[model samples]
Target: MEENKREVQVTLVESILIMIGMFAILGALIIGAEMPPQIPILLVFTLLMFYGRLRHVTWDQIFAGIIEGIKPGIIPIMIFLMIGLLVSSWLRSGTIATIMVIGFKILSAQFFLLTVFLICCLIGITVGSSFTTISTMGIAFMGIGHILGFSAAITAGAIVSGAFFGNNMSPLSDTSNLTTGLTKVNLYDHLKNMAITAIPSALITLGLFFILGRTSSTADLTQTQQISQQLQRSFNVSIWALLPILVLLLLAWRQVPAIPTLLVGSLTALVVILVSSPGYSVSQIGTLLMNGNAAKTGSHTVDRLMSGGGINNMLGSVSLIIVALALGGLLIQYGVVHTLITSIKQYVNTPGKLILLNMLSGIGVNFLVGEQYLSIILPGTTFMSSYDRLGLPRKYLTRTLASGGADVNALVPWGVSGVFIAGTLGVNPLAYVPLAFYAYIDPIITILFGFTLVTWRYRRSGKRPATSTATTSVGLKDRDQPVN
Candidate 1:
C-alpha cells in the first residue's frame, strides 16, 4: 500500500515536470522555433524524466496511458472533422461569400468596426463557433480594417469579443452543450438564463466599439472597393447559395447529430456548386473540397481570407488536438490530473463560491497546462457538488465554467488554441489579448451574476429539501425541488 502511494506521488511529480517542459517548448514554438524539432526534444525529455522517477512503469505502459487519456476526446475529434466538412461545403455553396458581400455593402468606414462586432455576434449566435467566425469572416474584416485605416489590434479585438460573446450564448456550441450536459440542465433554459448577463456584456462591448469606430477616422474607399470586388469576382455569390448554411443551422437547432448535420450541409453545397458554378468541373470541386479554397486574387489579404475548409485544412489542428489530448490523457492515467482536481475540489463550498472557483480553476488550468478542453472538464466535474449543496441551478454552473473555459483560449500564448489561432492569423496572441475585451469580461460577468442572485434559480422557501446530496455526481441527476 505504501509503495502504491509512493508510486502515485512520483508519477504526479514527473507529470508536473513534463507539463513544465511542454510549456517551455510551447514558448519556443510561439517565438518561431520549428515545431518538428521542438516536439521530439520535449518528448524525449518528458520520457526520460518520467522514466527516472517511475522506472517500474514501462514505455509501452506510458504510451498506453497516453492513448487512454486521449480516448475521451474521440467524440470531439469527430466533431472537428465534421466542422471541417461543414466549412468546406458551406464555402463552396456561396453562404460565406454572400455574407461577405452583404456585410461589405452595409459597413461604411464610420460603422465598419461596430459592424464587424455586431456581425460576429450574430454569426456566433447562429453557428456557435468563435474560432470559425474569426478564421472566416474575421480574416476578411482584418483586410477591411486595414483598408479603413482602423488599427488591426482594435479590429482583432472586436472580432474576438463579438465571436466569443455569441459562442457563450449559443445553444449549438460544444462548450455550451458540454456544460449543460455535465450539469443536467435544459439547454434552452440555460441560454435564456444567461441572457441576463450576456446581453449586458455584449451591449457594453458594442457601445465601446461604436464609440471607437466613430472617433477613429481612417477610410480608404479604393482599398475597400477592391476587397469587395475581389470577393464578388472569386465565387458565384447569391442568396440561393446560402441555403446550406441555413440548413446546417436549422439541423443544429434541432439537436441532430453533428456528423450528419455537417454531411447534409456539405451535400447541399456541392449541389449548389454544380448547378451555379458551371465553370468548375466535378474533379476540380473534389480538389477544392479536399484542399480548401485558395485566393487567386493576387492579393495576400484576399487569399488568406478566402481559404476555408478542405479536408487538408483540418490536419494541423487535428494533429495538435491529438497530441495535447494525449498528454492530458497520460496525466489522467498516471493520476496527476486526479490529484490536481482532488486538491482543487476541497476549496469550493457555496454555490457562488463554486461558480467562482470553477471559473478560476478553468482559467488556471489553461494557464498552467496550456490546454482548453481539460480546463473545462476538470473544473466542471470537480465542482458539480458544490452547486447542488447551495441549491443553485446546474445551468448556472455550466454557464460559469464555459464562459470562463473555452472562450479565452486564444489569450494564453502557450495554450494550444492560442498558438493555433496566432499561427493562422499571423498575429501574436499576446498582441491581441489586451484587445480581447469579451474574453476578459465573460468570466467576470458570469461570476457577478452568480453572486448577485440575478437570473439564478434555486430552492424555494416552502419547498427546500431537508437533505440533499452533496457530491459532484449529484448534478448529473435531476433535482426535483423548485428553485428560488
Candidate 2:
C-alpha cells in the first residue's frame, strides 16, 4: 500500500494564501482583462509549481502530483468527446430539430421558459449530459426566447438549472457516475438521495421562471415558422427523425454505460441521416460526422444553433479539464490542499461544518481551477478520511460533491462549463449567473440542510454503518443509519 512518494509539509496559512492568490489572479484576468481562462490557469500552475519547489518538494513529486490528480478525469474527457459527436450526429439526423419543432408547437410564448426548463430536465436525464442538452435544446430555447422578447440570460438560466438537474441525477451522466465511483457509492442510490433536495429546488426554479415568464411578449410565429421550414428544407424532419433520441432514452433507461450509449446514438443518427437525406453520398456523411454539420438554412439563428458538433468542438473544454486537473494534482500531491483542509479541522468540526466546508471547497475549486471535474474529485478525495472518521455516511459526501461540484461550475463566468455554455447558447456567462437558479441554489440548500441536519445521515456512534466494511470502500452501504 505504500509506494512511497515524498510528502511535503505545508502550513495552512500558506495553503490558504496560495488558493487566494491563484483565484485572485484568475478573477482579475477574467473580470479585468477578459483574457481566455487558459492563460491565467497556465500562469497559476506555473506559479504553484514554483511555490511547491520553494517549499522543498522535489521535481518528480511535482510532476507526479499533477498526473495523479488528472487520472480520474480521463474517462470524463472521453465521454465529453462522445457528447460532441452525439450532438452533431443528432443535429444531422434532425432529431433535435424535430424536438424543437414539437416544442414550439406545444409551447405558448407565455409559458416557454417553464417548458424549456421541464423539457431540458427530461432530455437532460435522458441524455445525461448538460453540455449536450444546452448545446442542442438550450440553443433552440435561447433563439425562440430572444424572438419572444424574453431575456436570453433568464432562458439560459432555466436551461442551466434543468440540464444540471439531470446531470446530477441521471444514472448515465459522467459526473453522476464519477461521483459515485469516486466515493464508492451505488449510482441508483445516489440518484435517490439527490432527489431529497433536487426536486424541491427544481420546483422552486420552475415557479420562479413561471412568474418571470409572464413578462415575456408573444413571440412572432414567423421566427418559429422560419426555423421549422428551414428544418424541413435542410433535413427530413419526420417522426422517423425521433429514432436516435428514442434510442438514447431507451439505452439510458436500461442502464447502459455512457460511452457505448453515445456510440449507439451516433450510429443511430448516421443511419437516420443516410436513409432520410436523398442521395447523400457516403463520403459526405463521413465528413459531416468529423467536421460537424454546417447548417446553411438561410436563417442566421437556425444556422447558428444547428451548425455545431463533432469532436473538434469539444477540444477546448477537454483541454481546460486536463489543465485544471493537473493543477488539482499539484495541490493534492504536494500537500497544499491537505494543509488547508487540516487547518480547517478546528473550525469545521461538526457534520454541518463539514458540509459547509465541502460546499465551499468544491466551489472554491471551481473558481480557482475553473472546472467541475476538479471540483468533485478534489473534495471527494480530500475529505474521504474525514467523513470516514466522523462516521458520516458517504452518501452525504457524494451528495455534497454533486451539489457543490457538478452544479456549481457553470455559475462562474471563467469556469470550463461556463465558457462552453456561453459559447454554445450565445449568452454571457456572468449575466446568466444569477439566473442559473438551480445551480446556485443546490449548494446553498445543501449547506442549510447541514446546519439543521435535515435529510442527512448524521453520525451516531463514530463508526461506519454495519453494512459498510472497512475494506469495502465509501458510500457502498445498503442504507444510511440515521442519527439520534
Candidate 3:
C-alpha cells in the first residue's frame, strides 16, 4: 500500500512539473522584457515549484541530483575555462590582432569579396565559433558584400549557414562539446557521425552561394581598395602570430583534452603577445584576460569587431548554463523527466518511431523556448530513457540532438542564434529562414536515417529480419548489445 501511494504521489508531481514546463516555454516565447524569460522559466518558477513539490526528497537527495547533473557538465565547463584562458592569451599574443590586419588587407582587392563567403565557412570550421567568426570575418564579409552590391540578407545567410555548420561539427565548438558530454560520447565520434549529414548539406550551400556570387554585381573598386587599405593600416599583420592558431589546431588534431589544449594554446599565445605587443607588461596582460581585449585600434568598426572573449564576456552564458542545469536536476528529482519519457516511450517502441519522436521533440522545444541550450538539455534528458529502452546507443541520441536540436534554432526567427544573426547581418531573420540549407537538412536527414534503419547496430539474438520493423521486448541498448 505504501509503495503504491508513493507511486501515486510521484505521478502527481510529474504532472504539475510538466504543466510548469509548458508555461515556461510559453512565457519565454511571448515575454519581451529586457531580460530573457528563460531565467524565470528555469530558476524562479520551475525550480521553486520543483523544490516545493519534492517534500519527500531530502536536502541530501536534492543536492545529489544537482551534483549529478553538474558533474556531467564538468567537461564542457572545463573547456569553457580553458577557452577563457586561451582567448586571453591569444589576445595578449597578438594572434587576433594579426588576423584582423591580414583580413583587412584581403578586403581591399576586387575578387576577394566573392571569396569572403567561402572563407568565412572555412574559418567557421576551424574556430568552431559562429559568433566569433561572424564578428571577425563576417563583418569584413559584410563590408566587402556592400561594396560588391550583394544584398545584406543573402550575405548574412551565407555567413550564418557556414559558421553554424562548423559549430555543429567542430570538435572544438562549445555546443558540439556540450552535446557529446551530455550523451557520454567521444567528441570525435560525434563529429564523424555528423559528417553523414553535414557534408552533403555544405556542398549544396556552397553551390547555391557560388550561383549567388555570380549573379551579384561587383562593388566600386576604389571603395573596396580603400576599405582594405584602412584594415591593413589598423593592425600589424604578421605570419608569425598565426603560429598559435596552428598550434591550437595541432592539439585538436591529436585529440588532446580540451582543457589542456586550450591552456597550452593560451599560454603559447601569451608568449607571442610579448613578442608582438611590447606596449603592455605581464600585469596588463592579466587585466586584459579578465576584462577581455580592449581594442585600441582607433577605428570604431575595427574596435567593435575585435574586442571580446574575456572571462567577463562569458559570464552571461555561464550563469544561464548553471541555472538551466539546476532546473534540469530539479525536473529529474520531481519525476517530470521520467514521466514524460515513459509516456512517450509507450507510443514509440520502434527504432524509427523513437528517432522521429526525439527529433520532433527537440525541434518543437527549440521553437517554443527560443533558446538553443534548453532545446538540447530538456529534450535530451526527456528522451534518454527511450533510447536506452530501444537498444539505441546514447551516441545516436546525442547525434540526433545535434542534428535536430543544436542548430535548429537557426530556423526560428526569434531563437537566440536567429536573433543574433539577424541583428548582426542587418537583415530580417524571417527573410533568410528558407535559405538556411543546413538548418533544414539536419532534422530531415535524422528522420530519414530513423525510418531507413541505415547504419543501425543491433544485438545478436534480438536482431529483427531485414524486412521487419516490429517492436521488441528484448530491450535495446545503443546501436547493438542487449540491455544489461
Candidate 4:
C-alpha cells in the first residue's frame, strides 16, 4: 500500500497482453518444444524488467518488489533442501525400502492407487506439507507404481491429490493457515466452511482413484517381490526403519517448525543407519547427505526407483521457486496484478457473479503471479471491500481463496506448486494435472456451492450491517441452517 517511489503506468490491456504472451510462449517451449521451464520463465522475467524500464521505473524499486515477493519463498526453498536430505537419508536408512516392502504385501494391487491417495492425504494433513509428503512417501509410491505396472502420470496424480488434500484441509498446513490469517477468518470456522465443498470433492476424487486403480493395476507381483527382496538385501527393512516417519509425525503434532523437524528426521535416519549397518562409515553417510542416495543393487528397477534424494537433487526446484518468486515481486511492484483485477471488478455486480468473480480472481492471480500465497492475499484483499458491502462472513472469502487459488497452484504447469511438485516427484506437472483430481475439483465445487447456497452467514441475526471496513461475526453455520 506504500506509494511507489517510481511507477510504470501500464494499461490493463497491456498487462493482459504481456501475460498471455508469456504464457503462450512458456507453453510452447515447455510442452510443444519439450524444453525445460526455467528458460521460458526467465525470459518472461526479462521481458517484465524491460517493460518496467520502459515506464521509467527505477532499478531499485523494481528490484525491491522482487526481493519482497521472493521473501516468502525462502523457507520453502530451505525446506526443499531438507527434503533432499530427508529422502536421501531415509533411503539410506531403509525407511523408504521398508514402506515399499510392507506396502506391496498388505495393500491389494487393485487398491494400490487409492491407498497412495489416502496415505498421502493422511501424511499431508499430519505433516502439513505436500512437498515433504511427496519427497518421502510419494517417492516410495512411484517405485510401487512401477512394480504394479500402473501409469506414472496417474500415480503421480494420486499422490498429488492426496498431498494437496491434506495440505488444504489440515490446520497445521502453512497455506491453510495463510488463507485464514489473511482473510481474518477464524481458522476453525474457515475449515468448517470448506467442508461442504472439500468433503464432496474428496469423495468424488477418492471414487475416481478407486476406479482408476481397479482398471490400471496389472499386479506384477514378480516385480514387487523382486523389489522387496532387493530392498531387504540392500538395507535393514524393519519396523525400526519406520521410526523416522514417526519422529516426523510427532514433530508436526507438536508444532515444531518444518526445517528443524526435517533436520531432526534426517539426522535421526543417519543415526539409525549407523546403528543398523555397522559398515556404513561417516564418509559414506557424508556422501549420501551431499549427493543423495545411489542404489547399485544390481536390479535396475530398484536402482531407478530408490535412486532419488539429497541436497543436490532439490537444487533445481529451489532455483525455479526463487526465480518465480522474483517474478512475482516484480509484478507486485509494478501493480500490474492489482490493476488487472480491479478492471474486472466492475462487471461483478450480483452476489452470484461476485462469488464467481472472486473464484476467477484467485485463479487469475494464480496464473499471473505464479505463487500460491499471493493468490490468497491478492484476491482476498481485493474483494474484502465488496464482501463487506454484501455483509458476507469473512470465512467465505478465506474458503474461496484457498480452494480457488491455493489449491489451483499445483495444477498450473509453470506455477510454483506445479514446478516444485513435478521436479520433486519426477513427473511432469502437465501430465499429472488431469489426474490431480483434488486440485482442480476444489475450485469447481467452491464456486458451484457459492452460487447454489449460502457458504457462511454471521451467526447472530444474520446482519453485520454493511460497511466498507470490518464486519461483525455472530458465528457461522452451513447453507441450510438459518443465520441464528
Q: Compare the candidates by lDDT and give the number of the best one.
A: 4
* lDDT of model number 3: 0.62
Residue 52 in model 4: shift from native, Å? 1.4
Residues 1-484 of candidate 3: C-alpha lDDT, one tens digit per residue: 2232234225755555665665566456535443553456454535444544455665555665566545544554555545556665655455665664555555543344346656766776776766656554565566456555667777777777778887777767777887877867777777887787777777777777667666665556665455455555654456877887788667756666556766777777777777767776878887877877676667665555455556776555455445545555555555555565456655776777877878877776565444567668777877776666555666677778887776797776545566556544546666777766667776787778767644354433364423124333423323433222
- Candidate order by TM-score, highest to lowest? 4, 2, 1, 3
lDDT tens digits, residue span 1-484, model 4: 2466445556888778877887898888888998887787788889888888988888888878888888888877888888889989998899999999988888887898899999999999899988778888898898888789898899999999999888888899888888877766678777787887888999999999999988987876877787788899987899999999999999999989899999999999998998998888888888899899998999888888888788888788877887777887887778778888888887764456677899898888788777888888888889876666666666778888888777899988767788878877898777889999999898898777776675333323455435433334322332223334
**Tens-digit lDDT track of model 1 for 446-481:** 888766663245323333322443433443445423
Each candidate's number of clashing pairs is: 3, 0, 11, 0
Highest TM-score: give the candidate number.
Answer: 4
Error of 2 at 421 (Å): 2.9
Candidate 1 TM-score over all chains jointly: 0.80
> Which is the better candidate, 3 or 4, if ranked by TM-score?
4
